[model samples]
Target: MTDVSRKGSLSFLNPFKTRSGSRSSSRASSVVDFKIGDDARKSSISTATIKETNSSGRTSRAGSAKNSLEYTRSSRQGSTLATTGEDGWDRDAQTGERKDHTDLLHSLVDESTAESLADKAQAMFIGIPAKPAADLFSRFPEGVWRRIVEFLGPADKASLAFSCKPFRTLLGTRSWTDLNSPQNRDAKFDFLGRLDEQLPNHLLCFQCGIYHVRTQKGQEVLRPTNVSNPIFNCPNVFNLENKVARHRITVGRALPFPFVQLILRGQKYSPEHGIPIDSMSRRYKDRDGEWTHQTRYVVVNGHLLMRVISSAFATPALPPAGLRRLLYSPSDNFNPYFSVCAHWRDGNLMPAVKCALSHIPKPPEGSGIAGTSAKVQYHFHRPHPIITLCSECRPMRRCPECPTEYLIEMRVQEDRSDPDPRKLFKHAVVVTRWSDLGDGSSPKSLEWAACNGEAEYDSFTALGKRAISGTFESQFTVDQIPGQKMVSMNPNKIKLGEKGHDWY
Candidate 1:
């Protein structure tokens, strides 16, 4: 019964103990081999056998079992054959054999491959002799070269082509073509087009008022003239009779491109006293206690351009309110008419004339009523052809008969016996031809005329005549014109005394 029980126990535990013992012993053997420096040979063999067993086992358990039993028997016999005292020596021998086999395998495959690659590289390098550093362009086809050129920046592309002859030939061709291409030419044209668009329209002159047109040739033309006449018989000519009746008129014609015509009227002032008023003044008081005014028109290019007149001078007897209302009335308002005819002409508007007119009071010249004897002079003097006013007054037109000269003068109007009268007036006058002096074309020949109370004529014409006649002739030459001399005024020289006060 004990034997039977022992057999049953063995049947149950034997398989498990055997498998466990074999795995543990294999692990222990690998550890021992590693300590003795013989692990490489043994580990390789053991791994190969295990891998084979695993692979074969998947086919059939019966075959795996047969191999396992055979492996156990061989392991036992080999262990017995291995001398206990000579284990280390045998391990070293096996290790040397495994190393030799590995080296032979590597020599058969890796050595030949490495040697062939080295020879091929050496041959290519020798065949393609080294030249000066060059671009990759020669190595690539034309299409690929174009793509490389496109990818390269301006500076890099230039350097690559210039570095070597072969690269230069390849890159230079495309570079030259690119520079002269139609696309490049079109780009230049587009740049010029933008520049042209930024330029302003130019003014052109015809028989009529000025017209605005493009700078380009054959540009659209738009003329501003009188619109009353639908058909412009002579578009450039100024008709005085028609202008006086309807003031100024502008006519425009649309060219290739439709354009709007803008007409700007000139500034106007009163004709009586040469004061600018809102409306034209019919009557004016003179120094002789007389009331009269004359309307004079200037025609340019056959068009009535400017009309000059004076405002009505009020007497001391008129009421202040009445004079104020009369001067302030809208009917007395006036603006000068400026007509332009040509484009690109210098000096479109006269700055001197504009400055002179700017000082004139708007609409009303004085605050007092009409007929008031409040002493009032014209806000501005008459416009003279010879006197150059400002930068805008270039190419001034001077009368051959009467040349003009400018003078600055100061005067004090004091009642008799008044100790401290504060009625001082300073004035700048541009005097015209006094007594038919030769044309005032040269500064050396120009003379200065006096503007004082004792002068014969109060008008600019009379003053001009007096100056030309040399009524107050002095030893000084034309070069002695006032304001021509420069002097430095020291602050210490200024005096607070009444008599010295007039020196300023």
Candidate 2:
């Protein structure tokens, strides 16, 4: 029976207590009770109710947090939902204040996604105490758990077993045992990668498939590919057959994988694990060529984005032989001197560069873009300082196979070393490559594998309409290129590399 008190006073619902002040049936009912001055206070849970709008256009109250709301004269008029405020939160019915203490996961992730389940799973770990969680885990049969884990991968199985002592006991040591197998090296590497937060003194080596002591640690510096620069001493370092993970930047420059790992590890965890991503940025001139390259990196959604701007001073109206001499490297299988992906030779990349070189404006009243008449060479009356490239080379080019995008352009910059004053400023062909290098998870990752030409990936399909160049460029400057068109580097979907003659 419900015993009601005056307004703003306490009420009680005691099913065991009779209205005649006598003992009744011994059935339990929720809430409080007090009998006269006997101090007969009892404790109970207080639950709030929230209205959930379901797919059927019906509003049903569900038990929730601490604050309670009672709907009065409410009807499902339009959509059984109220409009959220500008701040993306529901407001108080009368106060107009935002209800920020709501289910925030809805805003961050869709309920149907795996990320939402991960959040829920994390809550399961944090919600219960160790003893209680252990007790709860004891309720499930070990065989059932084994059956459930049968669908899990090696890394996932190890993760589950490693989460808690109860899980370890329940799952046994088979997952850990399996990780030690030679066939499960990838799985073990992936499992070890998860422990990155706890292991700052060591770095994962892809070739060796183990964590090595960081000998250089924070003092690590990127060096030339041929140089003996080791972040950590590995037995595989001296093995000629086992090369570490690295990407070729220019003809002579290469970016080691450990630096990428460091940059991403710092970004993913803390500075103690690695170094700041900005430390990876570099600007260097090739010793053998006139090409100068500047590389900058950005982290977007856990993926490493790289931008390399390679520029070379070009003479106007070059011959075909001079063009090949300027662009191609004989030592590197006729590859471009500028930064390019493994799929560079298959497309119109070389032809487009040749096209851009042809657009280098020749001085009207001079011998060339870099030279002038002997009399006019001393001062003034030079070519216009703007190098306007045609539509062929102006737009950005995205590789169809990998997540690399290229933009080729011509710019007029002052040639400080020029002897003549009139021809001091010359045209330079600038090739800017923006690439998505995947997460620093592993070498077998899609973007990384595709970048090295070891795996197949459709850049357009994976990246959609968004441009990596646009993302990389937006970080440094506000002066973004407007109406920038992006076309595939390989439009015909050709796969021939050195076998193709069009690369000439």
Candidate 3:
């Protein structure tokens, strides 16, 4: 038979034998043989292993094999066979032409063996035994898992928790308190460390885990230089720190406190100086309930002296529209309502105070006093004292139409050595009902439409006696102090709300 005719009848017995009664030349001296199974029934090779031979018929190049032999597999039913053609090419028999050699060496097994052989083939390809899928996260200890989770950002952690049931259960099941619990001591430190790494000192309140806007420039005046120091020395820093420490102690670890007080003097002082407006309208039930709106103002020294006269103008550099409109409006007039100021020099809390002189909820001292009264208290540290004033009253006015008036009184000493400072001066308006109080009154002192106590009255505030009355002290605390101690001397009460004194 011809080469083509012999190719059709060739079997596993003598695959390279020719019909012309001759042996086909072997490409390599070493012949590799393969067998599918021990079945006596018809068997077929599934892949055509081919290698190009040189003209001299020596062994082929190191990696010239075009096809590889897959492990032989069989079943009781039957098997399909595959072999190369005599022309030394793989061909599609129906097309009678050579086929491309890119196809993989895969087998066509009988129905009974298909699933078994498939699994075996897959396992061999992956180089692993078949088993049920397992949870990769559960395999690790909780500590390792927490470390991994800590590495992710808040957004990333949230996303991860949402991706799968197991992850959600692992992360969401723990409350914030649980995550911060003493049992997870390492985790709390890790969290704090991460916070330190990511959050800037100004933005972070290390004491309470609270974040604040760095609204004013130069807000942070002092920082503890001793890295070994466990507590923040500054009050502002420590106040927040103390709050956070208490919280963490309840939930997890207690932060060391009453830490050393290391005051660094000479740092720049940043004051919250700006315009604050308060306005409200009400109908007096006693006078046919007529609606009357009242607006009050607190003018900062910067707006009064600097920006008002500057030729160079920017929208932000201009005074608040409310302030400008109140100043220029017809019928409405400029009035000085309230003034409060605090000063700091070289890190020392040089005398700071608040004065309540006007708008006090009183019946002109004897106009028929009602069972109502109010008081204010101030607190401080070094740079400045944080002062909070809260008052309550119960209808102290003779006429229901008249609201009760209240005052804030604060007096600080200047030149501490002075036995007496000429009266007192106020940096801010203690009280006034007039929104138009921006004019007529000297920018140096706060004035009012009328004074109840001429010598004692500084400003005024109007509140319903029956409504809100509670002595609410300002929760103020000085955040910084001068490191060196200065002799606080015979300071006299600085004249406040006085005409000639300069408080700013």
Candidate 4:
């Protein structure tokens, strides 16, 4: 009643086929046919399983290029999961090796400080192409890229050069070679047509007084002074020359205030009346009746020092007009100060902006108040910031080893209350910064510091003979050594004695 016939027929088909041989002959025959069909189906499934495994293995091998660990481990982990049809495509691989690989990559990315990497990450997030900067730069034509770099200044060129190899090479090319090179520096100075063109931006050397302009690559470079380029013996040395003489600019030292004050006092009094200052002096009169004499005044370490070199006064005439006349004029000889002469000779035109003082001279007593002297009042000109040579000494001996030749000995002497006209020009040179003469036009009149007493026309007219002004006048006159001198001069030697033989 419960389908006993159907149950008996299905029993013959079981792997452990039911042993019902006597049950029915038809059932026996049916069991043999079913066995043949089941065997065929089992064989087909086994073949398909083998094919699927091989195909998955091949797929894993191919994908190992990108995600090698995942592919290899999935294969070794077994085909049970695949055959069983589980979703394990993105499953993690064996822990140790996989973790190490991930950590190394992460550390590498974190270590770099380049903004480009961060930019690339941002680009990745924003769906932009994260092409490398070097690659992008490489895409441009070399000439075009070079042209872009040409416009950058000293600082910008440095930053760009460090960015990539191409930029560095571009800078090394002739267009941007080392700025400190002799050729480059000479060209730069010549092209600008003025030495002071780059002065404001340059750094003043602490060892020498040269204001060094930095290279385009942002390097503080100096042209090496070898035997071939024997301009100055030391690279640190900067030579400043003028009509007066070559002044070796060394590190400026602080001058004593009392000493400077003494110099100022002497300069304030004229040598003829009181004691004429030996250094060159100029007198200027304004539209009003006031007289002013311009000389070198330096304020160093907040102390005022009056420094006077042996310079000659200029004959009263119209000041030089135009840049050429002002720079190269032979008659421009009012260089009592070193700084003033240096600047004037270097073609700086700032001091040339002179205006006559406001105080015009009133006629002296007698002759119904008529101006007695032809040049009653002096016309004052503003002094230059940079000083040059005031006068050239007679050519003397030069140093044999060095390019130096002794021109003239400039004396720096100290005078304290012992009034003697014979003992002057006997001290060390003390250079300092010049005080600013505000635009050459001041409401107040400039006072004649060295010639304050009754002015003597004869002493004023003397070019190089007024010797009582400086700290010491003719007490000691030392001569500079020539570069080619075989031997040094000894004052103690030479048996020639004074005619009177006055040793005492």
Candidate 5:
């Protein structure tokens, strides 16, 4: 019997305890060797022993050949493979193939898996219906709302309301009220509707007359300052009086006031020529028992007085020629008109008639011509107070308390050597009352006509001529009372000179 004893650390298990036989021995040893080899390879033993002889003492020896063979077989079957474990690969069981662990992990969590998770969570949370969006301006305080409205321009405010439902509900009502408020006076709608009409083109004053012209090109060209330019430098400036003098010669053609000529005709004098009278006797006693003589005369004082009262000469009449001319010619061959000369001073014109009458000495009271008295006053029929539209002149006019009336005197020079001799004619007619004609709303003064005696008629006629000639002058005074007057004067027909006059 071959005896084998397990020694050292294996002393506890007896190696010689099993039966020994030739056939049994060989099979049993082979089987035991196989089991030992399997245990060494599978359990990772540090040492291996061959039949207890020859103790070579190699403690770190590798496993026996049989054990190595068994390990190779197990590796091929992919049951238990010994590896360095550096690479991240694991052997497969059935095919014995190496597969990447990272690849396997990636396959488990892919795009489809992440999508499934997200869909499930979204379905769970978003199941309920959504409410409408809240109004953006609902929670704003009143102060904030006011600020917001102010920040938005007119167009922006209108557009914001129409943008969306919530904005319309909150801002539309408030914006409308704010836009229509009186504080927004410069707003397009407010200015166009209320202010534009009442103050169109502003106010203007030209040559003592006030007017309102329309605005051109959306702007007022002539400013209030421009209207007052003439009056600004000197309120008493009468330079334009000369322009009026030049205008008189062109009466009915260039003169602005046409009615003045008509008024003058009624006052023209027609006196008999070559009537010799003594220069010393101021009174002229006619053939009749009634005596006609000089009376009070009118005069103007001021720088403009001379210019305001001047006479305009009339053109000669055309000579008769055709058969129609005979029909047009008057049966009375004598002309009843005469020309007079006048001068302007201040803003007034003194008629030559007044000057001629003034040259005659005033008779004593109770004399045959003593009852005659001459007076002149302007009648303002429009009734409204005159407001000075010209800024240069402060508002001034005749009023009951400070009545603007004057007593004036005129002087006439008689020079025989002078080429154009002075002449007089009888008054054709008298006008007691004249209509106040013009647009009443403006600051225009009333027009006057003659009333009563031949002297009065001639006075008015000369006055008309002066006005049309642009030689009419006016002065301010406080002597006369503020009331209407009616007076009369004597009538006489006389021839002025050889010069023929045309009726205009």
Candidate 6:
């Protein structure tokens, strides 16, 4: 509708429509000109023309009616009109009171740069400190930061000092000096290991506590134990007295500490820093004994886990001497061809395998001797190919000295080399060992050392009821292997090595 705004100027007043879809006579409200942009939340609607008419219908103050903009809304009870002037003053036109001041955080950014409510809420919930809008850390004295640095370990202290130049200046170079000391070599290794992500082309040499250039880089491949496969040209590699760290995987396979480092680095950080744990897996056959081995790995709780399946066919109804040759590598260290913990001889591991092997069903042999006819006829009855062990050997066996678990199973597999079609399949003894190789942090790690028979370890107290076998197998096979029975290799808590007759 039309109305005399002020100074006899004709202005358009927006009509208030009722529910009946018709304009209704509205209450007399003061006119406030506001340049309302499309976004009312961010526009400077208050900074516009302001005019008030008294009860006598006389204009108290007025601006250029030809250029001033006007806006209208349904005025409700307890609602004051928004008004501002050319001077950009924020105040309530009705109460004539100034607007409240914005706080330090809000004042930094104007409405144009203001963060959305969702972004602000996310920042608050995530505890991300607002960008250095102020230098709060500078208020603290060097002595206070030094005290904080003293409480941290060598690695953490170095990390804090290396975080930023201000921190480096405050914490001083003492942390770096402490990390360089020989006594804190492990801490130095830990600190260097953290930089694996940043130094993808380099690998942390734990022995030297430095990042050596990755000589092989992406071309790194796991070779046999005897093969010289060096991922990095470390000074400690050829030092006979100071041997590079390694763990025995099987008879001819050794997992170098560098591979373990790279594997875990890939898992913990990025693929460029190290190789994938799946790449470390392998399947190979032993030159002797016709034993086949398949190795797989899994990372859990930051520790590298290994599972090796070694299977070889056993002649049915073999003698004790024959069982010895099948189980032990007499030509080598006399250790089992299958993967085993260092303390295998000190416990019932060998005895348990012998028991499992004895359960194999013996095939009947009928070669009749010539009685009166002087002719010979041969007949042999084949036994059931599938063999299942008794309750004693079937359960999973854990090494009390280390984080290693073993499960022996008998499966009838086709003997591809067997020429006779009738004897194509045979019962094979499969020994699967699951072990924890530690976190690849250092060479002297308890699990790694205990696995190599260098350090003492108590697997029961450390591992509790959770079996490594179950943890690793659950990654791929969806609980196909049951680990209900986990007993110590040394139930009697014995400590006899090769001196004991049972192991042999």
Q: Write the per-residue lDDT of candidate 5 for residues 296-338, one digit (tens) a residue.
A: 1112221111111121111112223321231121322321111
| lDDT on C-alpha atoms for all candidate structures | 0.31, 0.77, 0.28, 0.31, 0.28, 0.75
Please give, for residues 408-504, the per-residue lDDT of candidate 6 as tens digits: 8888889979899988977899999899999887788888998998898889999997788878877786437564588888888888776899887
TM-score of each: 0.15, 0.72, 0.15, 0.19, 0.16, 0.69
The weakest ten consecutive residues by lDDT in model 4 span 436-445
Find the candidate with the highest TM-score and give its number. 2
Kindly give the stretch of ten consecutive residues in candidate 5 with the minimal lDDT sum.
426-435
Across residues 84-140, which tens digit of lDDT does each residue of candidate 4 receive?
Answer: 544534333432222235776877888764467778877666866566667877888
Q: If both were scored by lDDT, which would come out higher, candidate 5 or candidate 6?
A: 6
lDDT of 3 at 93: 48
TM-score of 3: 0.15
Off by over 4 Å in 6: 1-137, 365-382
Superposed by TM-score, candidate 5 places the C-alpha of residue 479 at a distance from the truth, in angstroms, of 4.0
Q: What value of lDDT does candidate 4 attain over all alpha carbons?
A: 0.31
Candidate 2, residue 110: CA error in Å? 11
**Candidate 1: residue 114 lDDT (0-100):** 69
Ranking by lDDT: 2, 6, 4, 1, 5, 3
- Model 2: per-residue Cα lDDT over 13-130, one tens digit each: 5333322221221111112212112334332111210111122222223321111221222433323455532667666655577666556667556645546667878878896555
Q: Which stretches of candidate 1 lie over 4 Å from their true place?
A: 1-147, 150-166, 186-504
What is every candidate's alpha-carbon RMSD to the true fold?
40.6, 17.8, 34.4, 35.7, 49.1, 20.3
Candidate 3: regions farther than 4 A off:
1-166, 173-175, 182-186, 195-202, 210-212, 215-219, 223-504
Of 2 and 3, the candidate ahead on lDDT is 2
Supply candidate 6's per-residue lDDT for 310.
Answer: 96
lDDT of 2 at 402: 95
Clashes of 4: 61
User: What's model 1's TM-score?
Assistant: 0.15
